[model samples]
Target: MQVVLRKLGRGSRAVVGRLVRAPRKGSVIVIEFSDGMHEYVTTPVKRVLRLAGREVFYIETVNSRYRLEVRGREVALDGAVGG
Candidate 1:
């Protein structure tokens, strides 16, 4: 999916974007930004198993942490700026 990091919040922040490729259960999708930053969010098949049949799936990421959800993806920047 293509998303723009508009505002960064302290806790769980909402990511606004268009579902370019409707994510599937257990599917690991890549989120790319305008500034060339990318990150992968892996959906637990069990968590999204029900939504697997749907065309789009929205997932959430851990907040207030600076750990790279995965490798190769750029680390998210502090404040409201794309990494």
Candidate 2:
């Protein structure tokens, strides 16, 4: 499949990375981009292994912080950033 890249940072719409797999508490997801930049995001379930992958983009507002899930076209985020 063809992949697209974009700028990502602290904002409403940030296409950070693609989901490597299911994330649990303390788990990490290796988000890769077409530009060859990558980041290791922790998962709640367990540790994560970094890897290369595709990307995404959109505008989102979450209710909470500790809970973040992506089911199809929807990205679910719960809890607060620092509360």
Candidate 3:
């Protein structure tokens, strides 16, 4: 008998995009990034992940979970609604 194995793509469940954290404002920091086409936003955030050298970061909030993928300077983020 022969068995078949499937391969998984690099696609993730979280929203994938490019986003960078701002220089910090007051008591919070801002995330300014490109949506693969455009840039936007500034909000209070709680950092929960930071792994250098080809790794993904995951941050969880009261209502959402954010996954950040880093590649040198180029980065990717995944946002899951409703945590």
Candidate 4:
């Protein structure tokens, strides 16, 4: 498996990490970060798709007006503030 890291946001230096597991289709991708915060991302076979000939899936989470793009392709997860 291979892991990649990317940085996002400001004022706290948010860190991002990603892992590609074996079995390809039904592999669980675990994501973690600093500040004792972490999220578990499970990759189901249904989410897998051949994008430009490469397998890919997406996972995201939003909390307290902070948008988090956890895994897979590059996309922003928007969060709402003060509903």
Best by lDDT: 3
Backbone Cα, N, C clashes tallied per candidate:
0, 18, 1, 0
lDDT of each residue in 1-83, candidate 4, tens digit only: 22232222455443365443321333344554433366545433222222233332232223211223334544322211111
Q: Write the per-residue lDDT of candidate 1 for residues 1-83, one digit (tens) a residue.
A: 34432223466454443323433334443455444565544442222211233323223333222212222223222211111
Q: What digit string (tens of lDDT, one per residue) describes model 2 on residues 1-83?
A: 22122223444333344554444334443444446566534323332222223122221222212223343433322221211
lDDT of 3: 0.35
Whole-model lDDT per candidate:
0.32, 0.32, 0.35, 0.33
Worst ten-residue run, lDDT, model 1? 64-73
Candidate 1 whole-model C-alpha lDDT, 0 to 1: 0.32
Estimate the TM-score of every prediction: 0.33, 0.30, 0.36, 0.29
Model 3: CA > 4 A from native: 1-17, 22-37, 40-43, 51-54, 72-83
How far off is residue 78 in model 3, in Å? 19
Better of 1 and 2 by TM-score: 1
